[model samples]
Target: MSGSREWLCYTDGSAKPGTGAPGGWGFVVKPPSGSAGPAREGYGKATGTLAKIMEYRAVAEALEVLPERAQAVVFSDNQSLVESLEKKLESWRASGFRNVDPLVVESVRLIDRAMNDKELVVRFQWVRSHNGNPGNERADQLAAQGAREAKADLAVTTKRR
Candidate 1:
């Protein structure tokens, strides 16, 4: 809401088989500040034990890929993911991941990178999924795509990681 404008981001993360099987996560960035409505589409996936973290990492990585801007807000359907990324992560990390989700720890590192960037104003908001919101719908599509791709490649990456 400052000078010209900034980016409005929507992101989503998913785990295949409801957290058992490998899954993927993705995010869609809509830059309303510029003439183009969609700034970028980003997706990342990982299989095996780190499936959930991989999805969350995709969001943080997408932000890293965003164009330099003065302001931006990120929206997601996962409240715990948002809260863990924005806060609570530090305490969990300080405790040595004790009772902390590993994915949460990885997300913390990514969020920390953003924190150091002064020009960026990133806010994480929780939105209701499948609510008929276009942005969310788009994000969901991207996420699904990412997950499917990751699942297909899980066998290859599982042993490497």
Candidate 2:
């Protein structure tokens, strides 16, 4: 393991539409080699709200924001999400994600894009949430904040539009 580095990435999403708006997604990346870059954070909003979609979006956003040449291993609390991305993607897509929620498709697209990027080698794993993993906790908080911001921005944007 000497001179080898791995990146630990965590992502989360929130869908609280009770405020009369859709929710958002968020993600945070921590480098195992050492702290690096500006530390990334991102958010995206959608018409309806679902934690799965938001979670998928957050991971996608993180992948996009990560340095192109960096090698990474993403840790998520969602077992289904990880398994789908790491293994079941092709079958799911072929089956039209049958019996699967639309969010699963959206998430797969994001993962595919990330993997197809010219310079990314990503492996995903499942981590237990709220167990006090600092990086995961940070990512979770950032995700919640992103959701709130997205809802607020959506309201503002909708009003203006």
Candidate 3:
């Protein structure tokens, strides 16, 4: 691993575009050198049937599990979520995050905790989806599985991604 900051996290979420259809979120955190114990993956179901919410949930869940004080980049297919994390955070926070999704609020809070409380450096970046990116693809699969199963296994990990 390169120093103590050896993590990159990719996240994605899925939801049927309809009311009450259920949503799923997933994330994969891996070391750049692939030398860590193993890539950690997390997936879970959400009650809302909105991809945006699921996307936010995925990031929130991801930030929750990251190693304390580690520098990492979080990549996502959802541009809005990525922007929210990077660009629009202060404006939203100044307004008390009014009208923001609860999931998003939690995510921003986690980001703050990671930086201020945990001494971590978290950066956000956008990624194009379905372009055969291994980390994103695996997260997509886990999100799909969560959606199909309608499960709530948040923050849990399996051996492989």
User: What is candidate 2's lDDT per residue for 34-115, written digit by digit as tens?
Assistant: 5555556656666467778878877887888677767788878878788877887667657766745665566676676676
Estimated TM-score for each candidate: 0.75, 0.77, 0.80
lDDT comparison, 2 vs 3, better candidate:
3
Q: lDDT of candidate 3 vs native?
A: 0.77
- Best model per lDDT: 3
Clashes of 3: 0
* Candidate with the larger lDDT of 1 and 3: 3
Candidate 1 or 3, higher TM-score? 3
lDDT, each prediction: 0.68, 0.72, 0.77
TM-score-better candidate, 2 vs 3: 3
In model 1, the Cα lDDT at residue 102 comes to: 52
Write down the RMSD of all candidates, one decimal each: 4.3, 3.4, 6.9
Query: Best TM-score goes to which candidate?
Result: 3
Model 1 spans with C-alpha error above 4 angstroms: 1-4, 18-20, 34-37, 49-55, 86-100, 154-161
Model 3 alpha-carbon miss at residue 134, Å: 0.1
Where is model 2 poorest over a 10-residue stretch in terms of lDDT? 1-10
